[model samples]
Target chain A: MRTEAIDPPGISWHRVSPKYVTVRLVQWAIENLITVVVLTLPLVFVLLGWWRWPPLWLAITVPAVTLVLAVWRLLLIPRQVRAIGYAERDDDLLVRGGIFFQRTMTVPYGRMQYVDIGVGPVERGLGLCTLKLHTASPGTNASIPGLPAAEGARLREQLAARGEARLAGL
Target chain B: MTANVPEAGAPSAVPVAPDGEWLRVHPASPFVRGWVALAAIGFFFGRDFFERLLQGRPVFEQDFAGRAPWLVAGGGIVLVVTVLGFILTWYFTKYQISEGYVRVNSGFLFRQQRQARLDRVQAIDIVQPLLARIFGLAELKFEVADAGESAVKLAYLRMDVARQLRATILARAAGMVPDPARPQEAAPEAPEHPVLSVPPSRLIGSLLLSEQSFFVVVGGIASVILSAVTENRGFFFYLIPAVLGLAASYWGSFNKGYNFTAAISPDGIRLRYGLLDTQAQTLPPGRVQALKVAQSPLWRIFGWYRIQVNVAGYGAAGSNGETASRTTLLPVGKLPEVMSMLALVLPDPGTPEPGRIFAAGLSGLDSDGGFVTTPLRARFLAPLGWRRNGFATTDSALLIRSGRWWRELVVVPHQRTQSMALHQGPLARRFRVADLVLHTTAGPVSPRLTQAGLDEARSLFDAQSARARLARKRQISEQWLATVVPAPVVAPVVTPVVVPTQTPLPQQSPQQEGPQRG
Candidate 1:
């Protein structure tokens, strides 16, 4: 028995492609841009004193809050992308992600039921894909995003072969 | 033995369909299915018709005799059409049970064929609805892996034939050779030894003291009091739906747990339960992903406990609101009954002193019996339950206990543990505690040891991964009949190697320097 921490100190982690930062930024903008636009529209009228029906505090606070949340979210994307990493081990795949609420999962090759390689429209335009490993258990959420298509294929093939070799029954 | 049963290696005994040797289901299958729906429809429609007839004025007396023949003819036409529909449906549905697969070809208007590999079967259920039972028939449901739905449902086979067929399938699935020359045995069922039967008294008493009773009783009293005091009738409106919901839940549990009996046969762990519609579920050994023994606060007074399990294909049990009906292993049982059930689930308890660890998991307090408790500082986090919240492990499985009031013990075998995680929130981090969760297939029981010291959580997380890895390699194939399913390549035991380099992260474990290089 050895006393060890969950995040083993020495591991050559494969970081998601740097292009992932742009992908996340675009996704974040798409998600927050709509709310910012809609909420800011009301504030414009309030600032110009065109519509007085909405109370001054309510009109100012709503858009201000949306702007702060959007900017804060935009700022967090790069770090979150940086935090995502997956490592291929001899018998298992280690996936770690999340910035403030960090998590690392160790899924044995034998435990994987299937592997899915998904290329969304945006990721495809960037020549990138996301690889997801599904186990019998739904709780084992292991997905790696922003991989170069070629790298994704290689990982998928390697993972599938290893999974087949170590196939364990449910 | 029934004449319908085929001899081992015989091509077919029952008349084979024109299209190969596929066997047609009993003619009464559609009738049995139709009978239930018809009964429900009749009940509702008859109620309204009878009520209206009783109130209607007497204009029918003079013309009734003249119109009787016309009314009878209309009713006869409808009955003839319905019965013809049922007969046609039954005629079209056919199934072929063979060496490596069970294929079902069914449908009249639009034909559909389905085939599931015998090795992939997760469970076999022999269900006997009240109507079907009257004809001595049962339905065989095949739960296959990958797809959560029952792959093949063969309805209305004679009870004996169904049992014999089930035994054959189990034998075949276990990788037995389909020896054509060997004579087939009459009934292949390995004698089942009954393990536990919940007495009606306990079921009734347990239900009476359940959480629903507590809420209903308190809510009823409060509503009555409020309505009486305020002179308002609005409280009764809320109470109506509450009472109806509570009644439905009670009925569901009662129906499922009635006559509940568990036994171990060669085929699997057999469960016989239900009052009106009896069902016998056969869960093969090692099918269980995880199990939880739970006792609500009210149940604790009577030393009663309930058990629920997670089997791979029973994915919708929780979401469908049939958790109690489908997942319940033991509705209510004493400690001894619980122990026997545990033996069925885990033949190899892995620990020599099983009683000590299990007892600690069930009711032990303060970390006796090799159990590790949440640190004293966790008192601020969970003041009442903190003392009872702890974890213990056997060689094969890990047990986590929590909640002094609503006691629960969750067990997840090492091989079945899909993955694990350690979580530390701002509050838990300040208290130097973290939660460790072992992921398993979807089920009601979630195995989580919460509020453990940070260092302990991390260490357990690492050790758990190693144990799970080894366990996976050693896990036997689905062919339990053939023996252990250990991985083909046996590499010598080595600590899981860390990759040769490290890319620094934002947060590093400052205390992990000693174990880092090793």
Candidate 2:
């Protein structure tokens, strides 16, 4: 609720909407399910005698391993969502994420090429949007996922205007 | 200088290019494209067709003897259609350089018009493909800012005209008068003075000496042996295709860099290279975003270094949308050559004592170079390179020195830095060391100061963040011809035997203030 810009920058980190956890969980489930479906479809066809031989062990192992991985990923969805946090700095935007290999990226306002706000069908249903920020460097893959729609729009506008102003000043 | 720029749409005379005439490419332009198709056809069937005649077999009567006359007519019709297609393509393609924009109109059925604003022109390249080169023709590629996938390309101009057009367009872009003394049909002469050529012997030696070539040769030998052991006579045939493919690529790379020479023109650094197909690329000052001086492990034995750069829109798009060879500053050089190249590419490696820092960057660390090296604990992470993995900063850039056996020096100008990050892996966190990643545009120079003490990394994170911010704020235009006063030349540490590429001597101007001591 507090909108104060903290001193000793990046001290206070803003977390994405809590509902994002559920959104991510669903997305993860869908992705995993797709893998499971792709893996199992061939197995089903093979077992039904509709397809040619694929070695019995491969048919069984591929689906089984993929199902286990899908379940494992589903369990980690919450932690993955929790790891993401961003801070709006005076001259740059900082986004930090990743559970194992933790990464912290600072995208300067002046260097920003463009910013896009996207609301997918599921994200829209959840009143969430992803904020993607781009710079001239193609290496910059900085994006904030699961932001509330209003906050996402406001941030996009602010970043876009700041990007233009900074570019003009340069 | 700014006052002379004609306003958009006003057409108030800038006689840089001939006024308002849509110039068609050389009449032979269509043949260039047609020959490419012909080459493809010949490559697939020429051998078979020849073999039939050589063996005293009927050339065209094997299957079509009953209908030979009709088949011959159909083949002729097909050839005619292909020729017609190429001619139509050439007919539709026309480019006109006006006061404010370079407009290219092409495509026969689906008409397309692409214009690149002269002001927004970043760099111009004159590329000569093998066939085009054989015909003494070149293609002009114009890189415009924010024109994704649609960079205006005008192809198949007479080589002489291509170079002249490049010079004229560059002049207009730099807001300077086009050089009027240029001879109309003058042969392509190497620019006067201070041209650096990568000798063919050294080029071939360097290519063969590469680790990539080692793996390729080793793999080829291994496959050959394996096939021999397997008693498969067909395996030898496999080597034919494999070797042919590898030879083609190797030859392509060689040709791309054959007779490689870098010279200075009024435009900027002009590079001409290629054995079969020659190319001329002009990179004006301030266009290079970042630089990397790398020594492959095998190359280190010979004390050779390769310097590459990231110039937006200039390099060829590599796989994964990355830019490849287009940014090669010096593919292979010794320390002296490397240093000379660094002088041209960065001009100010951000340090007053560029030579000392550059030497330290290429080789191992000196006792008293201003570089901040990794702590003793970092030995576990970079056993051979812990002491050398460090960074130094200058007024306008941060120079990162890394590697031990194969050392690398990455120069990220403060102005060109896109983003900065501090990362720590589990091992790094345990060792109390982190990395400072300074991101520039996708280029060879992804400057990362790995295994720095945590305190140093944090300070770097904060300080570099501030430094990059300030630098971006004061960034100047990429087109520097109008504003550039000849920079004062600094004395080189080791005098290179050959003439160095004439670089725009950008002195420490009053505006680019010293990096504030935090």
Clashes of each: 2, 1
Error at B60, model 1, angstroms: 6.3
lDDT digits (tens) for residues B1-518 of candidate 2: 11112243524322222433466676677777677786765555467678888999888776667776775576677678878888778766666665446777777777777677665666678888777877778888887644244388777776656776776677556654322344122222224445577889888888898887998879878887887799787777766877787787677678777787877765667777778766677776667778888888888777878888876665434662114556787777788777776667666566678787778777857333688888987688888888888988888778888887777888887777887777777788778887878766555567788888887777777888888778766654544554463332211111242123333422112232112121
Number of the predicted model whose lDDT against the real structure is largest: 1
lDDT of each: 0.77, 0.71
lDDT string, candidate 1, B1-518, tens digits: 22233444554342221211456677777877788656765565456457657889554567679977976676667667878888777766666655356777677666677877777778788888888988889999888764366788989887866876687677667665443334333325668999889887888898999987998888888888999999998768877887788888888778778889999987679998988788988888888889999999899888999999987766646446443456677889999999999989998999998988898899999878788889998789999888988888789988899988899999998888887767666678678788887888877778889898777787787788888878877766577766643342221111122111233521122221111111
In order of appearance, the predictions have TM-scores of: 0.86, 0.80
Instruction: Give the TM-score of candidate 1 (chain A).
Output: 0.91
Worst 10 residues of 2 chain B by lDDT: B490-499
Instruction: Output the TM-score of candidate 1.
Output: 0.86
